[model samples]
Target: MTAAQFRTVQQPLDPTAAVGEIALFDAGGNPLDLSGGGQKITSVKATALAAGTAPTATLANGVLTIGIPAGAKGAPGTAGVGVKSISLTKDTDGNITGGTVTKTDNSTTAITVTTA
Candidate 1:
């Protein structure tokens, strides 16, 4: 020990501001079961979900309304097994412009629509 008393001691270049306590591990290293009741692990600030200016659906007589596409409204068949015979030949006409839907075991499914 003689290179002029071997002087070399300098370590504190912003060492994470000298962290006080943060030892929590569990991926087989055990010791991280936070007690199951007083949950504590907090530090989260990065948010962006508040840009508002575009939501118009007004109708006060100027009439701007759109919504009338229907299907899946078949319930109440128990008095004598009623809907066992209700076929729309397919065009339930919610508007694709063509129709065919016959299924109660007679099996006949073909409803095509292709438009670009």
Candidate 2:
């Protein structure tokens, strides 16, 4: 049976309260019989597989084991620099020629601008 066939059970007002019983139903709203030789999940295990591998699941000895592939690690990122202030360089006609970007750590970088 698929997980979609079972309905979710809502908890009582007190989450710590003991549950008397759980009812299982199908997608068609039909109740399932839990009478003869009903099996209970005894254990669950998860394994990490190599990157690019597909996820898999298997049931054995009332235990469920799943294998999940790990995603590839991305390249290292460049350090971020915060801007603190900027100083503009002006030409003879008071037109902006370029500027200097001052970082939070007191470091400065020059920037060029093309006036339109």
Best-performing candidate as measured by lDDT? 2
To one decimal, what is the Cα RMSD in angstroms of model 1 from the true structure?
A: 27.3
Give the runs in model 2 whose Cα sits over 4 Å from its true position: 1-39, 81-116
- In terms of TM-score, the best-performing candidate is 2
lDDT of 1 by residue, 1-116 (tens): 00011111354455768544433333343444345743443341222322342222212232322222334456787543222343333346554644466556556556666657
lDDT of 1 at 7: 14
Q: Where does the lowest 10-residue lDDT sum fall in candidate 2?
A: 1-10
TM-score of each: 0.14, 0.38
Candidate 1 lDDT trough over 10 residues, lowest sum? 1-10
TM-score of 1: 0.14
lDDT of 2: 0.67
